[model samples]
Target: MHPENTNFIYVNREMRTLSNIDYDITLLDWLRTNLKLKGTKEGCAEGDCGACSVLVHDGSNSEVRPINSCLVRVGQVVGKGVITVEGIGNEKKPHPLQTSFIKENASQCGYCTPGFIISGISLLNSNKDVDENSINDSVSGNLCRCTGYSPIVKALKSVGNNHEEIKPIQFVEQNNDVQLGLVSYHNPINLDELLNLTNKPNFRYLAGGTDLNLQRPIINEDQNTIINLSNIKELKNIEVQNNKLLLGSAVTIENFLVTIKDRIPELIELLQRFGSPQIRNQGTIGGNLCTSSPIGDIAPVFLALNAKLNIFGSNGRKKVNLNEFYTGYRKNILTKDEIVSSIEVPLPKKDYNLFCWKLSKRYDQDISTISLTVYIKIRDQIIDDIHLAAGGIAETPKYLDNLCKDMKGQKLDKSISLAINNIKNYIKPISDIRGTADYRIESFRGLFRRLEKCLVDGVKTMSIMDYNNE
Candidate 1:
């Protein structure tokens, strides 16, 4: 038996002081089975389905965003406030979004209703202006088989247009004390504690657990230790100094978007297509980079940005260029005790043009079949400095070093053709479920052709997928 403590977590203005709870179970299971809150349905155990969506206040920020409970572990919510579907409305009086759903006849089978309502509430809470795309993006993760999304979208518009002041139902107590769990769950307050904990053997560093949760069940091992890096002040810092932005590894993509919204419109457009709102709320830059997936949305962008990483370990700290970060497919040079602390992104010059594209089957919540990033400076139609990077076309996110060097001082049109030819020889993509190798190669050629057309003919910009007939 494990010993108990008075560590508390808030849910819907009511505080639940938990003791000796099982730390291994997911937040969805704990809510549905342990707490008997069955309103939040479960369609898919994975994060793809928004059926398990709930609003969580991280206790540090005033904004409350929706998150999938299926991907969240019970211990991850310590000192956080969670609001489920049950807390949104009562039998006597339903919430505004719930009432709109009823009035708009949005529910046919009603399995995905609660999730839609919760997500819609979050959308309204976060944004004062509502549009069709905004509503669709808000509930993109939710799927309804019986009823189409038209009525649901209409219902969201009705409730989301009202400018209402949104606040968390319960404010979690800000306790700086570390949470020691029955299992080896540790939340280090500072870098020293994190380094000390990492010095021990067989410990996994967990950031947001978006991708780690998917791997935990498959890689079933008796793993007892996880170092939570979300709460460390140093790891969550974002600074702008000397014409560059220094972003802590633990900063969520959502926070990063808000920070660089005005400064980097192109980057905002790219990240908006990264994942669903819920996943972006929880997913961090460090987690994305650490996974090192070939088709990861941010890898090519980081490569194009010429980013640098500040890595920490038991020994000390060291800096590494992002281009040399990945050694192989889904592998990096980090030791077991090393953790990425922060990232340095240089601001692009006014004369430079940065372009990013991702080709996938679905418009939302889909993995990329091919991702490309280009940073080029054109002076009087001659390419000056060109940096090209691509993913899903190599073992890792590859920087086209040879192609970039060859393109320098060449005419812009000739440089594009040269890069296209260089791709045929350099990139050897494998056949995957998302696409065929031949298909990827052809798509990239077409992408380059479109880029050339845009620069030469001054055509309006759209995704490469848009230009393709097939």
Candidate 2:
């Protein structure tokens, strides 16, 4: 514990500041044990169950979004505002969402009702006219043992359509721009303070804590000295510079979608299935890439787009292509001292054809069984450039450069046949829980065939949402 430092986090309407706090403690544990806010239940310690859902607002936008508390570290929300179920409404003054839930008989065992209420209220706070799809996606992370979703969905729609907009609790300004300190828990505000702490022995860097929290004692154990990278000013930027989209690695997935949705809608549609709204709120693009999961949703798209990542260490910074960053499954070329600073994506030309697909057991909040992305630039019905990447097929997400090369200079029909035959050279899928090796390979072949038909039909983009609608 560092006696010299004082950390502050805002919860409900109060500013809770403490000195020498443990940074690695899960926010759900703190809410239940320290604050004794029993309203926020804990069903699964992992992020799968949404019983620990709460509304969190940061200084960037002050817009409250629902996130699972069990997967968040206390240090990550030091300067942000958190609202639990208790803060939503009390017995004396019930929120409209609460009243709707009561009227619609949405509560079953009642264990998951608080989290569902928080999701409903947050949905109302953000969107006044949500459709059925939006309502379904909002509560995708929550799991109800009773399996009573019809009434819950009805309650959410009722609140979304009829409830009055309640003003969220205002955030308190905290001084987060302090200099570096030799503390067990570090919340650096600027690049210098963060860089200075990077090379220290056993110093672990944390972003959204969604994935890291699941690893528990392996990644962010109680005694480890952790540095919070979420609030650093340098890593929270998104800009277009020099004909490339430069995105900070620490940008939230939700924020990333907001910033680049217009430029790449097809990719955003695939990302929408990355996790539920709650998981995306607490997950970062950098964290997603750094985790180096073979089934990660964003890596295949970025690899196909020829994206590069900027890495910073105590010495200086270096940029590496996304295809070259990964060494193996759950392993990257990053040294112990280096951290990802930003991601650089070369903007595609106007005539480029981009497509991505995700196959999972469930439509929402599930990992990919097989993910594929294709980027092609054609002129006069002749292929000028092509890049393909696949996930959940190998130890790392890999670009099919050999296949792309084989398809170069060929017509759309000819390239289709070329890709189908050479696809096996690039990927060697293994049997796993999601699917068998033969199934994934067949799906890859089928995807190529469908891609050919879509190209022949003059399709510009392909999205699961669009496909479902069709």
Candidate 3:
């Protein structure tokens, strides 16, 4: 351990010094190339494949969570603890899960076993139930081409929940800027410090970094200054206030799902389809909105709920509705100096009937071709109020205020299909690689047609994919 150099991380329970590391250098590359720890394989570098998964224990949370090492930068884990496959065990003193994998023949071709083991370790570290569904869900992000995943699930089940526990460590605050050779990695402790650093040229706010890191340039490609917002306490909270759920911009998508699962259980399906386990663990709710992707999964549901965004800048804080936040494709109303602090979603009334869906080619880890959310308030079996929002059917995630209003006071019958046709005038979708414009339009209309079957007939087939032992 280098006491003189305060820049180091706990790699496998040992402090390793970091010196002159490249800015664009990912933790995967550093582990495989620099440290010679090639156990963490690289499959799809964009974080879809969990071959590069690892367990990281940061200062923000006491629990060790699984993250895609390919998407994590070197500076992000400064002073944190990282546990790779080597950290788990060896051939002589194999960990319980590793031994179980061998006994049950869970690993084939031996490529994705390390990541699955790491994910299993993370699952056991937590207090989750050791059952068939939980075991399947824990490794949903990991893929095994040779082994049909039944063996993997069996291995985890055989071992049960008694995992080799990771020793707890004290967390010290490291909120200052990190200076590499050609990169300036800024870590602002508070909102004011974050706003002041916004003046730096070529600046970008790093929230979950699930998107930005994928599109960032390579090492020494340009002198870029990136700021990490995960350290700010004001932007990482989850609380309920005055009948509204206030979700901080920095709250992970997984955390959001856990917090609102009981309150708004209807949204659980859509958020579960949002991404795999690793993607959900790293991507934040704010990053999903700020990206303003036309195919984003978070926007449609929030729009149907009429969420409000709290923005802050040097001038002061301001509130803007979600409908007015996006101006065009991937463009939002935020200025260079402003940052979204949190999202305010009003709790619905008891009569609220919410429906959310995302149409995609695959059941998991695929982009949305058409995402829809329809919220209806029922009064005496008639449609008292209605709100609809959709994505991938326009230049931006659109709110069908006028079209949904046309269905107000109408019975929840097939006659409402006439009003649903008006969505053609509101949306301006174009053809692309995902689907053609006509396909999107027709499919968009089909969601409403199915909506009737859902609300009236009580169908449970909307995005229905679960980790059940069928």
TM match of model 2 to true structure: 0.91
Residue pairs in clash, model 1:
none
TM-score of each: 0.93, 0.91, 0.94
Encode model 3's per-residue lDDT on 1-470: one tens digit a residue.
34643877777877777765755688898888878899999999888779999988875456888899998888787778888999889988999899999999998799999999988988888888989867777787888899888888888988887777765454553555676657788887778788778778988788888898888765666787878988788888999998889999999998998998778888877887787778888899999999999988999989999999999887899999999999998999998878899999987767777888888887677899999888887665578899999899877998888777778887777336665667577677899999999898888777777777666665433554421221
Which residue pairs show backbone clashes in model 3?
none
Model 3 is weakest, by summed lDDT over 10 consecutive residues, at 461-470
Error of 3 at 470 (Å): 15
> What is the Cα-based lDDT of residue 193 in candidate 3?
80
> Which model scores highest in TM-score?
3
The residue-by-residue lDDT of candidate 1 on 5-98, one tens digit each, is 4455677757776554544777788788778899888888888888999989866566788989999887777777888988888778778788
Better of 1 and 3 by lDDT: 3
Of 1 and 2, which scores higher on TM-score? 1
- Best-to-worst ranking by TM-score: 3, 1, 2
Pitting candidate 1 against candidate 3, the one with the higher TM-score is: 3
- Alpha-carbon lDDT, every model: 0.81, 0.81, 0.82
Tens-place lDDT per residue, model 2, 302-347, is 9998999999988798989998999998999998878899999877
Q: Which number leads on lDDT?
A: 3
